[model samples]
Target: MIGSPEHFHQLEKSLARKLGIAAFQSGLQVLRNDRGWRENEISIDYIWMVTIDHSYSGEGGIFAIKYKESKFREKVNPGELVQGIFTNKDEISQIYTETGTTDLRGIFDFNLFEGSQGITLDGVSYTIRISGQNIDTFISLSNPNTDSWKKWEAEIWALGNRMALASGNKEMINLFQ
Candidate 1:
């Protein structure tokens, strides 16, 4: 049920309704960390900051793809893809122009934590942390629970793959496969 057509359809509908967008399938870009690191030190985990662009409006939302463990040194390998909502000031502009606000929690129904880092979707519990420059926010899964990570990753990949398929992006679809 993770990557099923029905699942993808529901996800598209939910995202479009939440983000106030007409369509979720548009342009997809997967960005990898190109920065260098020490030999012994582990570089930043393979985080694919996927940008989903709207075909007609050019507006889109950014989603961060992380892994349960850092396997590949540089390339993105097949593993648990932890999905996160990443939004900075610049990226916020691309997502919301009419609202003119960068507070995602205000726009979306995201439950905020007092001191801890996590989010509750439906009944599942997942960690969430917001960090970056002023007005820049990144909601990532930092929970120690791999099960939760796996489920979240599957949903995200399904959505990502569906978008890629709609846009006819073989490269993006290949990554998920």
Candidate 2:
């Protein structure tokens, strides 16, 4: 039920707010909810953290896209909601921003590894995954092919290009190139 026109529209506005764009407009996208996963009843949601801005002192970084999915049963109306406001001090690490901790390393390979490296671009520190370039392969290997996966890959690619142009760090630029 995700990635309909309405969903993208919502994401665009969410991005604008996080990036501090009062009147922002661009052909920018963040992620796509893979259909195979979405169809699975157990698939609660997916979340991603993309850098929007960073601290001037370089102590930490800020993320604009705290992508999330909330489950709702059929015929349930969650109601309208305001956009989320995030800051560097806030706990933006995991989708579950809870205090409890559990050792999931042995449970899933996906959670065990730090797939992406953190980089600063336009004062925004993006967590770039080296394997994201091959996200297509990952999807194909793990799930059925779908347009949603293509969009997800494209969005990550676009994010890398944008990050490269805004970043002064050669190492960060090189990661994408």
lDDT of each: 0.34, 0.29
Candidate 2, residue 148: CA error in Å?
A: 1.3
Q: Candidate 2 — which residues are off by over 4 angstroms?
A: 1-47, 50-145
Best by TM-score: 1
Model 1 lDDT per residue over 1-177, tens place: 322334334544444444433333322223233353322211222222333322222323334322233334464434333333322222232121121112222222333342334553332222222222223232433222344445544554465555545545444444333
Q: After superposing candidate 1, which stretches have Cα over 4 Å from the reference?
A: 1-136, 139-145
RMSD of candidates 1 onward, in order: 17.3, 17.7
Clashing pairs in 1: 118-127, 118-128
* TM-score of candidate 2 to 2 decimals: 0.24
Q: Which window of 10 residues has the lowest lDDT sum in candidate 2?
A: 136-145
Give the TM-score (vs. native) of candidate 1: 0.26
Who wins the lDDT comparison?
Answer: 1
Global Cα lDDT for candidate 2: 0.29
Model 2 steric clash pairs = none
- What's the TM-score of every candidate structure? 0.26, 0.24
